[model samples]
Target chain A: MGPLIPYDIIPFEWSSIIAIIIGLCFGFILEASGFSSSRKLAGVFYGYDFAVFKVFFTAAIVSLIGLLYMDYLGHIDISMLYIHPTYLWGAIIGGAIMGIGFIAGGFCPGTSLSAVAIGKIDAIINVLGIMVGVFIFSELYPLFEPIYNGYFYGNITLEDSLGINPYWFVFILTIVAIIMFAVTDMIRKRVKKVFY
Target chain B: MVNRKLVKFLSLRYKILAFIFIVLAGGLVLLPKHEKQEGISPEKLLANTINPERYISTDALAEKMINQDPSLLLIDVRNESDYKKYTLTNAINIPLKNILDEESEPYLNQDAYDVILFSNDHFHADQAWILCTRLGYKNLHVLNGGINSWYNTIINPKMPTEDMAHTEFELYAFRKAASMYFGVAYPEKVKKATVIKPVTKPSITAAPKKVIVKKKKKKLPIEGGC
Candidate 1:
């Protein structure tokens, strides 16, 4: 029956309000889970903690399974859901930059925003740096345009390109995530613990 | 001893995690996959089909054309050959067979225009209408009686007898004016015999011809450039 906005079940005017509510909930969850703590977040990179990995992987699998179940029960139209388009080189370079940023700043965009809400000086600097980066990117858009727009692949799903059955793919992915979680926990136990 | 060791290896938390994964995986594997339905359900389609509101009568269609309603989009659903031979002014040809094709989607699956489908008769037009209707297309209507009705009513209308009701006479007069608007030429005798004031021809200007100027293709830098 959904997406509610596209189907007009929920009017388009309500989208921004709905998005704000979801964003608030996300920030609250991140803060509650100690994600706003730079030391806690950075622990994942240093191998002292695997909370991020466990939480994110659990969230992914839970949402995947839940959406599939909803689709099967005729509650939602899975095909109508938006898929972020793949821009091959753009994604590769952007991800590398993001990964480096995460390591250096000890907080990704969302967690940094959560930290900023609690008046963390480092998070405020990080957010300012993010805005500066965005401004620079916009100013020099033409320079980045080629790589950014190149190798454009239209909105596609894993099932589309890989020719895999969605159910089987999700099942295998869930198993893999479970294995990774257990491995991360073992690695965390062996590593020297760093306390904030 | 093996059971006790297994219990020790898998703690209560792991046990719960494993249980959740197993249940999810079981549901995924056991649930029957239903193929995505192409269009509206049969029940909805049936209800829509029986609705008479979907048909725009020839007179109403003619009236729209005379008024040059911007929202009205006439679709000639006959074959390409027939379309080429004869079609309504500004009407786009989309044969019934190609009604569901990707190329026709921009024309049919839009809310901006009230697209009316018509063939020689109601048959092909009705078929196109049904196909589009099933796909949940909005603002679609079948031109009742199609082009055949248009020709009979607008292009060559029957004059009302002297004893006919005033409304019938008025309708006949309107159709005569519409026929002239569509460039239908009546005999001089018939034209002069009308007691009503002469209907002035609508001023229609020829569309400006398109002039094509091909530009030289410029080669750009290869992709993945810094």
Candidate 2:
């Protein structure tokens, strides 16, 4: 009775339309929240504005809580949701590269698109850079295959990997996030303010 | 004054974080530990389908078929060739791979019939049963020894020993008559060699094969996701 598209409760034809609607709404929300500005995004690195951290972390926690509660109430079967299959080194190395890229470029893929929607020339260039990176990686896949396919752990949730109860993990995460938020605020005060 | 200023400096963002933290902490303390068992755990599905009630014995299926029970639906899960060679009367051929197809869903997922799935042995039928059970389909039963048992008991029943109970003999006699009704020559008649030669050969021999071939062509096992 849940996961409508996967369960065929909603016809397959509507999937593209639904995806477009969701994507548009997501972009609109991001743009409205001033994510189009690279300075605001870079603030997370520089310890100036923490909008990036606050927004992203809040969204994650909110969705985490919503999904868990929805699953508990039997409105949706949480188990059916796809977990990204973990390739340990690939994730660590790829994430490190992305983190470096994020600090340097001040735009991740999604925020770059939102910036592009508002006609930011830098974001347009950033998107081109991402495309080129993707193209280069695809062309050189054989060279990177070892790292890409190495340490193949199946799709697993935090609880599965850590052997902790999901509720306790969520509670711990929430506390950690709260402490980070406080720390970020203090750091933002100490850092010299840069107006964007 | 510094403490009040500090409190005032904690903006809407911090307020939201504080609120979420308190809620999460409360939830963790009060709520029972939610075990995050990912994706309809295979172990649980195995346990669910392992129930004895999940199987319909060959004898019970034979009785239901003999009665021409409208609520009984037999599903042959063998390959097309095997199903064409021999299958139960009125059984729908939903080969193992096609059991989850949209076409077969109407048959397997419905409660209107006591849907009994069978293959050559219990192997394929149990596989189908596990699949249907995992997908949360109810009212499905596996044919306990599948068509192999059906043939052994119903199509060519063994006569009871002399010392067997009257009820056992009665059941065997009923099975013998059912075998005759289905046009299977008894072992005793086959041993006589010439006794059932005329009775066993006819258009009745070609009818099942033809029907199965036609059904196989119509239900050409569509590829479906598990």
Candidate 3:
């Protein structure tokens, strides 16, 4: 269970510092890659840009494949990795709300934080919106409990539930990502240009 | 052939594509994450299940019981009814059903104890070890040969001599019964009769696996209990 901090290899005190450093790098890469702009983030919804999709999908696939490879190499056990529990309704409802949040605020949590680092006023607004969202969620936690804790299937990964080799899954995901990247590029070429 | 078209040229979103190589590069760094190679196999587990860590041993465990370390969370992976008969001092109850529930209040926000699981044979403890390890719980250890080895090594070091006193043998038998019940008894069977006189052999004996499980180097007093 690589939460390296828990193993005591790295002390927990460093987690925040580590998080900030990771965030800084994340923000730097994200903003430098043009995620700071609201229009860019919203392009996915309006069929103008797929950069957000490409970056996120690529990262997920890469990490999945890399972690699985590490498992195969025996440097780590794949079984120990954390899996977000599947909440069927949460996935659908929470995802829809997030999509709305994405379209309205034009900054998801990470991008907004990165944009805030660079001192974007709109990004600051988006962040405040997020805090309000967080507060609302907490206040209404009881009402949201049905989706939040309803469909717990236990800590499960794709490999654990599907009974497929992680390597195979990662390989498939990588191939799918590559195909999406290529397809998206083609689609972007044809879409009506929306200059921001 | 033509100057960049407006759609391809105008949007900053295409910049996200530039980092495709970066993601692949990140994978390179993650591949060698763990310094130690995991050599997990059923055979290795079968071979090394009873093989005790140098820090853990029968004498050390027995000594720990005597001193009574509060930090020690000695778990008996056996069933419940056996536990009721008698258990070591200050030991808590958690059978194999949710053995990993040391912090099992998963649904609720609660702190679970640091639990150690033991069984009659090292096999049970070892099995629990595998299960917990897979589940990613930290700080788990096997109690060598659960209660069986404890009876063989720590509780009784000498063969039952003809002159072995009845009361001493009774004490050992009582402790043995406690160990078995606490360490392995599941399904909650009532305590067995306190038959203490010299008997033909111990009811629970760990053979072939005996030497490795119970016969490892004894733990010195320097390191605290198992």
Query: Chain B TM per candidate, please?
Result: 0.73, 0.68, 0.45
Docking class of 3: incorrect
On TM-score, the stronger of 1 and 3 is 1
- CA displacement after TM-score superposition, residue B195 of candidate 3 (Å): 23
Question: Residue-wise lDDT of candidate 3 within A118-175, one digit each (tens)?
Answer: 8999999989989998999999999999879898788777667889855445555665
**Candidate 1 docking DockQ:** 0.44
Model 2 CA deviation exceeding 4 Å by range: B1-13, B32-141, B144-226
TM-score for predicted model 2 compared with the true structure: 0.59
Which digits, one per residue and each the tens of the lDDT, describe model 3 over residues B1-226? 3456765665645455545544554454455444653334455555454445512555556656655655467776677886777555565556667665655423112234344566767676677677655443455666766766666765544434335556555444455554553454521222222222323556543232343334233222212231
The local distance difference test score of each candidate is 0.85, 0.81, 0.65
Rank all candidate structures by their lDDT, best first, as comma-separated numbers: 1, 2, 3
- What TM-score against the true fold does each predicted structure earn? 0.74, 0.59, 0.54
**Candidate 3 ranges beyond 4 A from true positions:** A1-3, B1-226
Give one digit per residue, the lDDT tens place, for model 1 in B101-174: 99999999999999999999988998999999999899999999988999999989997654556666568778
Candidate 2 yields a Cα-based lDDT of 0.81
For model 3 the TM-score comes to 0.54
Q: Candidate 2 lDDT, tens digit per residue, A24-129?
A: 9999999999998999999988889999899899789878877777777666777767789999999999999999888888899999999999999999999999
In model 1, how large is the Cα lDDT of residue B212?
12
